[model samples]
Target: MAQKNIVVIGAGFAGVYATKKLARKLKHNNDVTITLIDKHSYFTYMTELHEIAANRVAEDAIQYDLHRLFGRRKNVNLVTDTVTTIDRDQHLVKTKHGAYPYDYVILGIGSEPNDFGTPGVKEHGFTLGSWESAIQLKQHITDVVRRGAVEHDPKKRQALLSIVVVGSGFTGTETIGELRDWRDQLAKENKLDPEEIKFSLMEMAPTIMNMLDRSDAAKAEKYMQKRGIAVMKNTGVVGVHEDHVDLKDGSTFPTATLIWTAGVKASDQAAQFGLTQGRGGRIAVNAQMQSQDDDQIYVVGDVSYFAGNSDRGEPQIVQGAEASAQTALSNIIKQINGQAADVAYKASYSGFMVSLGSRYGVANLMGIFHLSGFFAMLMKHLVNMLYFVQIFSGYYLFQYVMHEFFRTQNDRNLMRGHLSRQGNVLWAVPSRIFLGAMWLVDCAYKVSGKESWFVDKLRLPFSWLQPAATSGASAAGADTTSAATGAAASGAADTATTAAKSVFSLSYQYGKDPMMVFDQMPHWMYSITKVLIPNQQVAFFMQKSMTIIEILIGLALVAGLFTWVSGGVSVMFTLIFCLSGMFYWVNIWMIPMAIAVMNGSGRAFGLDKWVVPYLQKVFGKWWYGQPQSLYGQDTVK
Candidate 1:
């Protein structure tokens, strides 16, 4: 069998998914080689570029290493080089490094911002296209805010604080939404009046998010307006200068920043390929996503223009890119297997979700269901989690949740665009001291108790170890021990017997000893806990180790050493105690506090402020001992 070269160009949403699918589909075929080529060494979550630009997320949060993405795929070879041209006649792709021939090619190179020949827009307007661009924009925003803080002249200060976003589409809306929150925080931190910060989202169309239903668009606009973002409808930017944007209405708004999210067009390579170019310079493709001129070459993502079966053309969104990639990959596989390329692209538009800052969002589901407020925010998170699950491991999803959602203070500080030198000192010190004191007190209580506090308190939750007597005699014995009168004793005995039998019988049957623990917990919880720690010896070891762990957690928190690890461990222990029915109310409180401490709470006051750096120097950036700043300096201790 001759080895067939299958080359995937670009590492965007469509390209990455197509490569992964190809790798899975052809893993068993020894006669096929899959090569993924991208100019960048990492894949950026382009959808989250707004978060990056707003400084709401760490740059690392949106980037996943390309090598790590394909580390487990034996047949996939990643090439980090720019694609210069494609020779359809010779079945080869030319790169800056070299030329490579391929049996099948998939292009998902994505698109770049279209300036539309607007004067000064290309040179002055910042874009949210790539990681570098997003970072640069973030820096520019930070610089403007910093400059605004000291500028005495109101006019100059206003110009420094104002931002004009050209377009009210998803990217533009999200960008301005994040900026709204960021600007407010910046104003507060700089001691400037928040009213001075100006935000404008301009759209040439009558409404924002025109692709969405009118109701959803209206909801988004209302949310934006409520957040103080000026939604300038039926407005277009004729020109963008260094310090002002010239609107088509002959109005000039003084702004230091102009974000160009108006539109994107296919990469220049699309036009250079000599293929049939369609609208927006995108390569024209058939229903199967194959090039109009060459069946062997398939184009997907924003770079592909498909005049589909419907009146509307395919959208240049992630969903459309994924759908096109699937269709193209399927056709390529079919052709490889000596079958007809018949599969057509079928877009699955589940819904659209737009986040209005941190906690607010609006979403339209399947053009039928509409949601707003926390539910919409939750849906947006779930969608992002789904994407994370697809590209990375469950651990990555956990990290994403921890970094993006759980740690609010840290995220806010990040969004504010600067890490103060004394930032950690302000919050981490008090939190660490308090959390450490609580842990130490808990350890003392556990150790001072007579009898193995571990067995009496923690182990008592599992009825499987010590079965309770359900006999009526046991209940009668309890009544007699109470020393009641004859008639009262009889009545009390009956009541005690009924209650004892009810609780004991259930516990024995279901392995739940709620009598000594939290009686409020559901029966299923006991069943789960019992199944997880069924072994007596294992349970005993865990019970004994908890006290020691508590002591160590106290010491670590007090010393401000390995605060995140200790705090996470503390959270785990607290959860275990709650599940085992130890201290329900106390554990609940401890859980949240423990989470707070996990965000590098000890960095400012505890030894971690200096210890972390020293350890990083000694250990050379080992995952566990990195500097506290690695987790975000503004993170709670």
Candidate 2:
């Protein structure tokens, strides 16, 4: 068989997704090689670009390293170069560095800001079309604010502080929302009142969020108005300048920062690719996502115009992009296997979610349920996570959580800084020690426990572990008093006597002393234990093993070594006990303590500080390929 070269262009949502799927599906096939080419090395989370533009998150928060993404795939090659043109006649993709031949090509070059021939937009307006553009917008705002702070002239200061966003779609609405929330904090830092800065959303349409239901749009508009943003409807920008924007209604807004998020069209570069172009300069693709003019070439994302067995063409949204990519990739894989390229894309849109800043949002779910405010924001985050899981690993998911909730500054994210208010892990040292001490105390009593545990104690068993010496003890339906007396009488049983009741028992009486025998245990819960512990020998072995594990867990916690391992064990044991009808009402704090400590709490004044790094450097990969930097840097290749 001849070698097959599958080339994926652009690293946007659809491009990266198609590349990842193709690589994974063809990983074992030595004859196929997947090349993912992009101008940028990292994939940007386009939905969250507003965060960067509004300075809500760090500039790099929305990026995923492309190298790390394909690290484990031997059949994949990542090319970081500008794709200048595609020679469809020769089946070649020409980049700045070189030209490569391809057996199959998936074109998902994404979109560019459509100035709609509006004069001065490209020259004077800021855009959120790409990561560079977002960073540029943020920097420009920072510079303008810095100048505005010191400017004494009232008109000049107002102009310098004014920010006008022209558009009311997802990008424009979200950009304004984030700016509205962040403006106050930014103004105070620059020694100006937030009111001195003006924020506006100019929409040429009668209302904003035209794609959303009218009611949902109204809800979003209400939220914007409440946030102190001026909503100007039936407004059109005729021209944008360095410090002012001229409107069609003979109105003008003097502003140094004019962000254009009104519209976008397919990348103009595609027009030169010699593909059959359609509406918006998007390549015309069939229902199978293959180019109408060329069956070997497929188009996806915003650059592909496909009606796809529907009345309207697929809207240029994230869902449409990914769905189209799936169809394109599927057809290519089929054709590669000598099968008909017949997989057709049927547009199935669930709904849309638009965040009104990080704290609030509105969503129309399943084309049925309409949600607004906090729940809507939560839904949006969940949807983002679910989508991320498809293309990335848990490594990115954890990063997403950290960026959106725990690491976000000034309560600018959905969690509103509740999770962000983290203190030194060293402060948890005392609590860690306390938890370890409780486990040790529990293990002490179990090691000297009667009958079963005595068999394994040093191979001869502790004398204190023996049953009480009372004559009537066996017939008295178990007397804990006699057991204690016998334990105290043995001088070596001091450790056992000190902890008469296990710390886990917490003195909760379930119609009797729960520690003695776990009386009134649930039948269903103990069914498995009963079968496994049928004989005295197995029971004794289990008892001894449990005792050793508990002791080891305790020591590890106290010394702060492998806390994730020990803490995980502690939680499992605690859950086992609780499930076994062991009432631990008073000592239930151990569960949460164990869970909390698992988050690298051992790094503080403990061996884990040294051990974890060594493990990550040497034996770092999770059986899957992600680096084992749980709470450290993502040093992915």
Candidate 3:
């Protein structure tokens, strides 16, 4: 078999993921090589550009290192170059330094901001297409706010503070939504009143968010209006200048920042190739995503115009780009395998969710169900997380979680500042140590009871070991010995602690010794108990083993050695005890403490600060054959 080269042009949502999918499926095929070429070292998460532009997240939050992504894949090759031209006849792609011939080509050259020949927009307006542009706009916003705070003239400050976003698409609406959060936050930072900084969204159509359901769009508009964002519908932007925007109604508004998110046209590379160009400079493609003039060349993403089965035949968002990529790649793979490229592409989009901000959103799922507020926002984040999981696995998903939840600024995240708690691991040290001390006390009591754990005839009262009938009889026998039945409500009666009434209106109490709170043990637990301790000798051995485990867990936690392991064991013990009816209301405090201690609590004043790294070095050598550890430092082989 002859070697086949698959060249993908861009590393955006479409090209990168298609290449990744190819690399995985054809990993063992020696006759194929998947080469991913891009101009940058990192892949910019384009959907998250609005978050960075509005200062909700840092610039690096939306960047995924391409080298880190494909480091372990042997069959995939990474190229850092700007593609100058594609020779369709020769099946060759030409870059500045070299030319690479491909058997099959995937064209994913992305879109650029469409100024629509509007005067001065290309020179004066900012567009959120590239990572650089987003960062530049973010800094520009900050500079405008800073100057507005100290300006002596009121009109100049007002002009400087006004920010108008012309377009009501996802990009425009989402950008304004994030800016809604930044409005008050940046105001305080600049020592200016938030009300003075104006935000306006202009749309030429009768309604905003034309991509979404009308009701959802209306709800989004209402949310913007409530937050002081001027939603300008049926408004046409005729011209954009250095300091003002001229509307179609013969009116001009002064503004320093004019963000243009109106429309996107295909990149110049599309037209330069001299293919069958369609509207918006897009190359026309068939249902199989193959170019009209060439069957070997497949075009995906925003640059490919497939004007069938879809409303407009052009996809602007990430979902459409990804779906087109899938369709294109599926046919490419089929053709490679000598099968008919018969996978027809059609548009069946699930739904759209627009976040008004980090805290609130409106969602229309499957065009049937509608949701708003926190749940909608949460659903929107879950969709992003799910997408990250699909394109890239745990690493990208984890990074998104960290950026959106823990590292997010201004309490503007999915968790709403709850998971943003930082610098508190040191404070958990006291709680971790205290919890370990209590476990040691319990172990001490178990060592020297009337019938000690390992001594003659172990007398450990496992509440779930016996049947319900036997347990009830034992409780009945002990009641005759209780002389006092009427103690105060707060006091224990008959040596049994009275619990709060159950939700089912069932009265239950924590038993002293002979009985437990749950009347019947679960079937699984009963079956396991029968096998685990069938005889006195087995029960005694099991009790001794349990005591040994407890002592080790307590000592390790107290010393802060392997706290993740010790804390996990403690949590397991806590869960088991609660399920077995051995834990009372007083013992419930261990659950949170167990969880907290596992989260780097031992790093502060604990042995795991030093121990985990050495263990990581050993584990690294054992697993990946490297002296340098995966999670820790380098050590001897």
Model 3 per-residue lDDT tens digits across residues 1-637: 6889998988888887788888888888899988887888678888889999999887889988776666666787777777888897788888876678898888998898897988878888999989999999999999988988998997788889999999998889989899888998999999888899999999999989988888888889988999999999889989888778899999998898999999999988787676897878888999998999988888988899898865467667778888888998899889889999989876767788888779988888898889999889888889888876776566678878888988876788877788774546788888888888888888897788674676856464543333332342123212223354532221343234323423222233455322334433444664565567666677778888888898888888889988989999999988766555465544567888898888888888999889898987786455434321121111123
lDDT against the true structure, per candidate, is 0.76, 0.81, 0.79
Off by over 4 Å in 3: 444-520, 529-552, 559-566, 598-637
Query: What is candidate 2's TM-score against the reference?
Result: 0.84
User: Which 10 successive residues of model 3 have the least lDDT summed?
Assistant: 627-636
TM-score of 1: 0.76
Candidates sorted by TM-score, descending order?
2, 3, 1
> Tens digits of per-residue lDDT for model 1 on 128-149?
8888999999999988988988
- lDDT (Cα) of model 1: 0.76
Over 4 Å off in model 1, which ranges?
145-158, 189-191, 310-312, 407-515, 518-637
Error of 1 at 610 (Å): 11
- For all predicted structures, in order, the TM-scores are 0.76, 0.84, 0.84
